[model samples]
Target: MGYWSSVLLVFLGSCSYGVLSTFVKLAYQAGFLPGEVSGSQMFFAMVFMWGVALLFSRRKVRGKQWLTLAGTGLATGLTGILYYQSLQYVPASIAIVLLFQFTWIGVIIESFIERRRPGVEKVAALVLLATGTLLAGGVLAGEFGSLHPVGILFGLLSAVTYALFIIFSGRVGHEISPYTRSAVMLTGSVLITFIVYPPSFLLNGALTEGLLVYALPLALFGGVIPTLFFTLGVPHVGGGLATILSAAELPMAVFMSSVVLHEKVSLLQWLGVVIILVGIAVPELSHKHRTAAVRDRG
Candidate 1:
């Protein structure tokens, strides 16, 4: 696939994720608790992804890949739990912004694990992303009232776990098919969710109804599809580029909130969003330019 095609795939994946938050919020409004909503989503996603995997996969999953997928799934499930928990205490917009701190978390983790410093472009991108996130989130305007400390901590934890997911999955290499890997991960997530919240599936009331109606779609769009796409596409695009493209989720979420939820984003917030996009784009563009220059020189 060409570079632009890969980018388009990533964009579509991000947009899918962007639309997912609204469904989650709707589920919450319908009275589902965080753990219950999260558990149900994982369970359904596993079932769906497994069916898809069976259709597409030709090779069987090996023991090592199984282990990797298990670990990845556990991390992913816990991240979802933490993210949902944050939503209970904070606005979806704020929780998402905090979760997106993963962009920097990924960079820092990659640098430390590789024992190498980040390039100038990456460092600049990180700074811009950070500053822009704060601005967009209105963190500087003393608007932290909407943010709970516990929720903030969980959000950061989600970012860390997500970064680990990307790092470990990347290190696992590309031998395993995306279909098989997604199936394994989804199964692991299902098991972890069941273990953590056994009563969730057993609960009776409006919550279950909400899960069936609203959260199910959220899980399918936000939980299942994005994971599948990223697992497949990131290897082709590289994590750095994927991360940059995934930043689109932030702006897309804001746009969706405005259009669907009738939420108003301040001018500063929109400007911050623009700045963040520039930050993500600059590094990729520079890298592409340098690669072309090197090719020409050769």
Candidate 2:
């Protein structure tokens, strides 16, 4: 796929993730525990992704590639579990801000692994994305006064794992078909998730009790779509640009909370969302302008 196409894939994947928190919150309100919510989502996602891979994917996994891909998926599963756990101790606003630290962390990983400093456009976009996240997540609105240490740690851990996920997704087994890669990696994720959360809901009739409602949407948006899209797109775009585009998640989260959950979003939050869009555009627009100028000179 082309660069722009890959960027779109990552952006859409990020937006799908943004919707996850809302559904999690809904599930919690409906009296399901975090383990139930996360485990069911993983179980359903594993089933769905494997089904698709069996039907449509043609790529074969060579020796040790499965191990590498599955190992990388540990980061994915940990990210979900840790982030969800953090929400139990901290305000959602604070949790989101901490989770978004992945933006810079991702850039740092790219820099370290590639042994190159990030370009000016990426730095600028990171600054804007961070600033906008603060406002959009209501961290600046004084709503997140509690800084629980455990929550902060879990949130930061999630950020690190998420950063690793972005980097590894691009660099490791990227030649594999997106379908096969997604299936294997998510299989690893589901294994780890099930080990930690223990899919007890499968035996206790939680699905019949209404957890299935949240599980299906969570699986599709959080598990399947992002996994497939990231596997397909991150390899092409590289990690740095992909991280910036994934900032689309924050604004979309804010919008979804406002629209779907009837959360009160302030004007500043709206402004932050706009700023985030501008930030996400910064690199793409700068690249286009440079391309145009070079063409003119040519």
Candidate 3:
């Protein structure tokens, strides 16, 4: 039941991210640049985090742990920046496919940590996941006129950094309260975002306009809630299963676009969604078989 509860936590976190892109698109339509979008989210997220930390995360962050958590948070910032920047040179379809590579990357990292190669079941699940991501992202149907080397580099970098962040989040600072750790991490994200896109524009009325237009939704859906859910849940689930569960975001996004944006989802896309969900369930559903295989190997 505890494991299933962890799965539910990851599912909820991934669901928040599923609807995040729509809010981001709304912000973009309101004329916010990527930097502005990222920064405003971070800035507002910091405020929300601070309030949450004060209320529940009363524990003070110490020396190295602060830096460690902050650094992991900064990696989250980079993941957003790199992914968004990649879209300038590549289609969103390709970029989405690239970001989803973190699924297998997480598996590899976990294999090393556990000092055992993943069984065939895990590998099959990853292949199914990648296939599903491609279909769900519309990469199978999108035209690619050109894939810029720089954009591809950024995309791959984002995937690696994202994988590392999940691994780090699950493994580090086990003693800290989730609220406090996530708040500290968000502060790190805010600093990194500010350094890249200075908030001086806010003094010139950008803040009020952005806030009025899109801050609350973006901060809540994209920033505060997802971070809180992932931080609170991943440690219990471990990085591998949590990462697999994160695939829930793509399918949820497809559903959201269809319902809210009135976008059409292709038959192939629906199929992909089903496959991804099945992939997420594979490990848990096949637990006995996997354990038997492990025992046989030993």
Candidate 4:
């Protein structure tokens, strides 16, 4: 039950991300730049998180903890910046495949940092994730028309940053309340984004309908909710499984795009979506079998 709860939390976080891209697209159509989108999202999310932390959380955050969570935010915040930049030149399909490399990158990072080898179970799950991402990205459907070298770099950078964020958020400041920790992390993100976009949001009609209409929802789904969910849940499951479970975002993104955005999804893409679901389940089932085996031995 505990494990399942963790899975539920990670999946919820992933789904929040799943819906975020559509909002980003809408914001762009409304004439917001990537900087504005990323900037406003972090600004609003940071403010909301701080309010939550102050009102509901009674715990006082230490200076060191602040620094650590801020570092984690640097990674998360950079993920948004870099991923958005990647989409500028590369096809979304190719960029997505590069970004999803975090699935295995997280696994590998955990392996090295923890000084442990990945078992066969973990390796198998990674294969499923990679294959599913390939299908989901329409790699075989000829959707990956062309690539940009810089966009590829940015996409890969996003994957590395995201993997680091996952690994650190799970490992750091476990004693702090999620609200407080998330606030601190978001503060770091706010700082990073402000540095990138500058203070233009103050007087540049940031509160205009175009930005406000989608910006608020983007911050909630893309920033606040996912941070809280991941901060609360990832430690319980470990980063590897949590990352795999996050594969939910790809399929959910495809489904939501089809339904809400009225985008056309190819049959092969739906097959990829099903494969992603299978990928998510493989780790859980493998863990269940191993647990049962240990129980029987005992």
Top lDDT prediction, candidate number: 2
Flag clash pairs in model 2.
none
C-alpha lDDT (0 to 100) for residue 234 of candidate 2: 91
Residue range 126-240, candidate 1, lDDT tens digits: 7888888887877777778756799899888987777676556555536877777877887887787778778445556544454678757877876688777777676666665
Output the number of the TM-score-best candidate: 2
lDDT of 1: 0.75
Q: What is the lDDT of candidate 4?
A: 0.83
Candidate 4 lDDT, 116-193, residue by residue in tens: 997787788888787888787877876655566798899899999988988888999899999999999999998998
- lDDT by residue (tens digit), candidate 3, 149-213: 88788878888877877778877777898888888888888888888888765776877775446
Candidate 3 residue-pair clash tally: 0
Provide the global lDDT of candidate 2 against the true structure. Answer: 0.86
lDDT of 1 at 137: 79
Q: For candidate 4, what is the total of clashing residue pairs?
A: 0
- List of clashing residue pairs for candidate 1: none
Clashes of each: 0, 0, 0, 0
Q: Rank the candidates by TM-score, best first.
A: 2, 4, 1, 3
lDDT, candidate 2, 184-243, per-residue tens: 889888989999988899999999999999999999998999989999899888898888
Give residue 19's lDDT in candidate 3 (0 to 100). Answer: 74
Tell me each candidate's RMSD, in Å, in order. Answer: 2.2, 1.5, 3.4, 1.8
